[model samples]
Target chain A: MEKPVVDQAEALRKRAASRRRRRILLYVAAVLAAFYSFWPVMVMGLEGYNIDLGVIIAGEAFKTTTLYIGGLPVNVKAIIPTAYYYLQDLGLEAYPRLVANTLIVAGLSIGLSLAVGIPVAYVLARIEVRGRSLISYLLLALRTMSQFVVIVPLYIAYSRLGLYDTFTGIALAEQLIILAVVVWMLRGFFSDIPRDIYEAATVFGKNEWQVFRRVVFPMVIPGVVVTTMFALVLLWNEFLIADTLTGVATRTAMVGVWEGMSINQLSFNALAWDSLNAAGFLAYIPAIVVVLLIRRYLARGFSLGAAR
Target chain B: MGAETRQGRRARESRRWYLLFIPLFVVVGFVEIYPLIESLYISLTNLNGGASLSNYVTMVTTPTFWNALNISLLYSLSSTILAVLIGIGLTFILTQELKGKGIFEAIYILPLAAAPIVVGVLYSPSSVWDDIQQFFHFILHQPYFNELTPSFYFPVMFFSDAWEWSPLIMLVALSIVNSASKEVYEAAELHGASALQKFRMVTLPAVFRSPVMQFVVVLRFIDAMRAFEVPLAWTNWLGYTNTLGSPVDTISLYLYKLLYSSSLGFPLGVVSAVAVSLFVVTLVGALVLLRLMKAVGG
Candidate 1:
């Protein structure tokens, strides 16, 4: 008995030591991976700040001094108002409109996706229809089709249909990508709802539509919200379709940034750098805000889709 | 008579449910399918709008198409492989017992939320490229490491894509790992399985068994095959050396150049042919991926 007890204690201690070592190893690996992944963003953020403040920390021009604020030594530096310079280069009047246009395009695209996607997802989830798998495959194909491939014909079609450069046209073009994702994600959510709830509602003399409206729809509100958020993020970050389809009237902030870079390249204009970085910063802000706000939902949404 | 009527009503109701699909089908058909058909038709015709096999013949014969195709394959294969490895590794590490795992996981996935364009700009010659060059030069202490070359572009593009997409794979892996039955793991442990054995037997198989994992793998493959924004932005910054046989011009970028470049001025027929070819390639690639996954019991 004594020998068995001693052996058990020894095994327990060994297990505890191994577990501790594994935990330490995991933490170290996670931190390193996180750093590798986020280093680029950090570099970009720092670059943006340096440009916006007209301070080159890497250069000898950067100066630091200790300031006595609230009886504490605080690091302070001379900073130029590069924001004003950026604004001047960007043409203060054009900047707000550019931001507004990006917002409008993102908003309209999300709206269009939701309006068309929910009903279709409902059918895909609830109704046992013939050729459901075929529809799913079609949606997947649409999702996989390179925007470049579709944009070619769509460009010609848009120009012919008088839809080019219009908000509605751009929004519709954005829908090509957003719709597939919305439908697929929403379908996942809708299917996750317990079938017994829908059956119970139907047995109470509710029509299929009524059951959808009263029982299924409410249950998937969280899903809709998350899906919409995901779609919004995708649209807001969208550059390809918006770049190809939109003209002067409907150019988004992303396009503005791209054009700024192009102008700098083509003309070797120095001021364009300031404007480009500023525009890049502006374009990134909403996505950052959205990610921060909906981080949990975004994680849940991605995992949920994968779970299906 | 009553039973027949009930069956008929049930049939009618199910049929009406399909009516819900009509609006979606119309929009997709009008926006997606119709254009695709029109494009395919254009691909099969000559400049004079007459039916011709010239475009297809040219696409097959042209070295430029093959070069672009090769570049695209390289980009997609390298990026997808690296991303999946990193993603799976991160998933395994993250699932281990660690403090502040949530924070680490959140930060790891931040790139997913970022726009590809933004990621492109961030990694382009303007921002992190300089830092990367400097870091590399310092490590190697070689003059050759200082300049960004065609070889450098591959890794840059690969890292940018992997950064943005690895999180997606991680998400899928995590969900699969988390949802795995604890009993199964315990059973493996009870069998006196080593850590490596447990992982190989229980964890890896379980994760791969999920259909969602298979879907993600296939989707990532397809997406990588069509990589556009990052490479485009990178090349744009690097000054558009997207000539017919250029090293870094991906298939989509090549197609974009064909359509947009004033000097090239490719005819619509040829452009459409290339587009159709790209679509077919994606489809075939997807099918192959699915088959591979199935073969692996994933």
Candidate 2:
């Protein structure tokens, strides 16, 4: 056999060139990703600074730094904090009530869904029932149904049944979203426990309930916590149902923000960008904190707990 | 006799487990099924206060209804596809060996915390669009693009949705990509596979063929179809729109108008018919997708 000659320097040069290209690509991608992810948030926060291009264009006075690039003026305002004033304009009482309503509704939703969902999820996971896939598909179908489809009828039903405009009503209506998630996630988590452990525990003369309590429940406590947090996010941010169902007393933070937008629109003849941005940023605080807290479990949660 | 009794006892024990599903069914039945049945009944009722298919006739005959249907499909399809594409890109970048990966990942996930209303408010014409308009005006000497046009409205909606949701897809895909063995890629390289060949044979299959990614994709698609918040926030829940089925109106928005803001009255029957139709459409879409997922996954 003829021996082939190797061009070592050329190979090294080619590899280095490829690595350089990759490195450049990585840098570009990272920057784009950063800009794409955070631009909206940055815009929201920066709008709060009350940056006025007109002021810079006019070359006005009072705590303004103007930068000229390509003969275009960029005015960087001195942290005017207009958002705070707008929040103040939103009034103090409404904000607190909105927060309380959101919290109460969220609390009730989480408690109810978990109480009802855990048992269903556990049974579906461990038992091979004939109606298993049917139940699952039903849940998935409900999840996919448009909020308007269900909420319209629920609106009429709640109005007639005296459930309208109550905290309990809002909480109950939220179950349409929360229960599906709770069951789907908990089922995924419950199934994660190997069947061998379950079988071994059963072989030790433990009943199905005992096996669940001692073994399965203990194993998926982390999952339960994550599910609770996820449900809380869903409830806190829920708009359409809460917006329609809630009256003045039960107005959630999200509804409050919408009301703020309408108020600004009607009065000011302009969208209250600064105040609305401020309100939105304020409203998202709890969700952000909770999401960060459960960041590690997010891969599973985002997949509806289908992925591990 | 002992063996028969023992078998009967085991069957009884297993049957007891079905009782656990009672609470779930009760809540779902009262909350969901009752309303669904009521909607069906209402949809069958006519405008003249009698039982007929008049609402279904209206739904099928209205041109604006068809337009709303088209807009809904376009919005949902574009947003879902964009979300997956961007998510795949983010996943690729994120999985590479890079500095500050953790921080980048955290930044990416920040959008998920944003409420839909907030996303809508953030992307409204007077805010981000104005900024973008100024940018185009300054940089390219382009005139301010009218927001009412479909060209502008659709892209803004798509981008806003993709921004808010792609992180979720990214996270799921990242997990899948991370869980895959590195040796597979190395083996492909050893086999003298080109970079494109290696990616096609290795990375694409590892991520797309997984059931989890498929689930996430379908989930996004289905969720996107329910596009409500952005359209509502942009228009102030039709506070600004003069007519039903405006340019920005998705099917959900159109349905809301039919139910709440009709010129004649609450067209309850027609709205209910639309809701029932939507229910059927979403269910069928979901079933078809799940079937497709299984086929592809296998």
Candidate 3:
């Protein structure tokens, strides 16, 4: 009634073969997606080589070098590490300082937000706070508000207060961006604790602060750590606030790279492309390392704790 | 009587926790809300010392302002839709039983770490575009598309955006898929549901059922609406008849131009007006999209 046994076996084999084929296809697609995701980074990472080579060739050692293909002026610049080192010697002296500015600003902002945000999140999550929903919505709205809306006024205020171009000034302005993220993500983390645990801690005659310190805070340490690193990456990559607020001494590496790009593109004597690209790559090293390390937490972080 | 007093005391105790919110409220209020209010006030006043609606009038009458709005809408919609679709496709591929899944996931998330400006810098015409042009010119004997046309910059912007943001949606959707019970898939297969049917009725529903997906779409759309760094960085800054409004200038870039462009004399009132209008538009767009999602989900 089910058909011949041999025929049934053949049908199962065919289905298995198709399944294998489909699996192969999906693997190929995933590989392609990975490539697509980091393609620009790879390009940016390699671009320095081209510029460095150009620098070397432009020097006295390679003045006669001219590349042509089919009588067309086609200069195929190759990767030269020595040229990058040379450019690094000349053009990248300020890179270390810019990177330091970025780290200091990002660290200060993260510390400020976390110290401030963790408590607010705790209160909202566990306490019977009034207007919790209103506060929540306000934070969400703040997240979507354009940076320029506030930057205009802040620019005026910072200039008048002599806070313009200072690290503290830049960090203060950045709270508009990072604070909402901290509160939202940590609120999600705090809310994940069971009501029973909170109640049980309260039953032990512990005050709210005591219970939070001994119990819930320790429980969400992992989440807090992840959130800190995540905020660091966001603050590190932030351009508008830092670009607008910072001057020469306080310019974060991101703004530095941006200025480098502008200068390279506009100026007749371009800054070595290799040096700029290298600076660009170096600017995001912490971000790249942190993101990869926290890949497991990415779903939770990206969803702002909407997902388990 | 004792219970009533205890209840009141507990309520008061909990109210004290609200003080914990003060630090955040103070910082955000000073830096964000105050500036926002100041911006609104500035928008309604004139730089020459008189309050007027002239800033709004000037903004609304500008052709470039209208052009920027159109570009923002188109860019936000098309790029977000494309990214979400690609994200969904990626979720399916990634959920497959494959070797090296971890490594691939790590690679996929790398773009999210790159700043928007970095993406723009990397993919600028002088760099990546030139490479592509050279490839075609050498291998296919095609003419180089060297003109800084909309045809070139817009696609690069969209692609860079997708490259950066698609991973966000993927991570959200992938978590949903991973969290789904194995029993559901087994049950579907037992019912002789084909692969397509399983994906349609099972995977798709599981992901779309979450409000997170809607939030992500809104996030992507609103962020794209404020597209600045990518377009700003993509342009050859001092070339081609523009310093700010170039091959593509969304509303934010236009505001930057208004604020910083020497020809405009750094018109703060006009810039504030444009920013206010942009914020209103973004909020309305987000609310409408959220409402649409709710309707669809219902």
Candidate 4:
């Protein structure tokens, strides 16, 4: 009996210890995963900031200058430049042109998408159209088709039409992605409006256009905002289309930065790491800020179409 | 007579509503359908513009094309599987009672906002790659840390893609998991089911059985299969030219090479053939995935 009791106690202790061990393992795994996720961003931010700071405080180094802070020697020598200096270093003509082009392309793409997408979404949502499911499936397939697949033909067509190396060309290519997403998202939003609301509007003798313009459109404003924000971010980060479609004249910021980096790579010693990082940082900030500013909408928007 | 007129007017109104679809159809048709048709047509012709099936035959016979297809399959399948697994694991841990989970969630998603080129730059030898290398070499004392090897190339590419995309999967999985009814779990507990048993019987099916989950999977797979930017940036940064049989030469990149940098001059016809073929493959794959998911879910 004593031997059996001892054996039982040992078993219980081992089980408890193993349970504790498992919990520790779980905690460790979580922390490690989080670290892995976050460290890249942290590194990029740090490198980018360091470079930007160095550029901003460009000044002659006072050789042999040192300062003591709590028994630690610190070099108080290197001086950074002003924002103007850094901007000049970032290529005043080219950088500004790239920025303008990026903005224009993104703006035009968004405008065109909204113009095209809103009406289609309304029709799909409110009107009882034949082969509605077929249309939706077609849109899904188009969305799934990689941009690269279409890009080949697009390049040839753009070149043929003299749309190559132009802002409109890039915008048109970007619209391929933007329009589909907008239509899909807005359809979901529009469909969510209770059928009774449409019936009530029709009962009030409101025409189809008026019902859409006055009633359905107003109700889907939140969805519109969410879709717009997401679309803007996507358009801003687009590289493949921009890289292919645009030449020197219409090169967007993404393409410009890439080319600049590659050019800099050839002369590694004289490479403007600061300028490169600054450009990268500049490129990255808008999307991050936009996303964070409208994070709530994004969270809701992401869950809206699919989850429903 | 008044009710008949109202019904006629409603019919007219619905017909007019169809007009609203015209602009969208025109735009999409011009951009998507036209290009697709143009690609198909181009693929069926020779460089001399003569109609022929020679382009498709050439693509089939080309070793580079086969190599690219193999690499694409390897990269997409491996990356998708790993990312989904990691995403599932992260979702499981995240859904548990943990402190500061929100911060982790936010951090996990930060990569999604970054451009692929930016990601490549961050991981390239000129930047944090060296730091990562040193961490392995000096800290871990594992010398001979060569990142140029195929082993390094595959994993780095996989990790980079996964880093950007896994968060999306996590979000989707979490949404599904959280939305699962608590009553099921309570019932399982009442039945004296163990934690693992309850999770297997309840949580797994709850998350995986959703149609939305399958949609997300197919979408991610398509994206993975066509991955270009990250690999391009990495190889560009390293000045590494991807030849035939190169591990990193995804089909899209291979197509790009043919279009822009082919030694036999611009093989537009062959590239177009490859594009059309890939498009068909992706569509069929997506359909098959949908069917499989439906079968499993049911």
TM-score versus the correct structure, for each prediction: 0.87, 0.90, 0.90, 0.85
Share of real contacts kept by model 1?
Answer: 0.52
lDDT of 2 by residue, A19-119 (tens): 88988888898888988887777777666545533233333425666644235676745434454534553477778788988999999889999999999
Q: How far is candidate 4 from the true structure (C-alpha RMSD, Å)?
A: 5.9
User: Rank order by lDDT, top first?
Assistant: 2, 3, 1, 4
The CA lDDT of each predicted structure is 0.74, 0.78, 0.76, 0.73
Off by over 4 Å in 1: A1-22, A51-91, A265-275, A292-308, B136-146, B188-201, B285-298
| CAPRI-style docking class of model 1 based on DockQ | acceptable
- Between prediction 3 and prediction 4, the one with superior lDDT is 3
What is the Cα-based TM-score of model 3? Answer: 0.90
Model 2 scores a TM of 0.90
lDDT of 1 by residue, B1-298 (tens): 9999999998988888777777788778867888888889989999887899998998888888898898888888888888888888888777666678888887887788777777776777766666555544555564535334877777888988988889878877887787777998889889998666777788788877777677677767788777677777666656664455556778988887887775786678888899888998776755654454344332
Task: Locate the minimum summed-lDDT window of 10 residues in model 4 chain B.
Answer: B289-298
lDDT of 3 by residue, A148-171 (tens): 898879998999999999988888
Q: lDDT by residue for model 3 over B82-165, one digit each (tens)? A: 888888887777776779888887887788898888887677766566566666766577877753666767776787778788
DockQ of 1: 0.48
Q: Write the per-residue lDDT of candidate 4 for residues A1-308, one digit (tens) a residue.
A: 69999999999999899878867877887888888886766655544433222222222233335544235676644332324324543566787788888888888888888888898888877767776656665666666677756888888899899999887778888877777778877877888899999999999999777998899899999888888888888877877888889987888888888777767655673325656766776777788777776554443344325643
DockQ, all models: 0.48, 0.54, 0.56, 0.41
DockQ of 4: 0.41
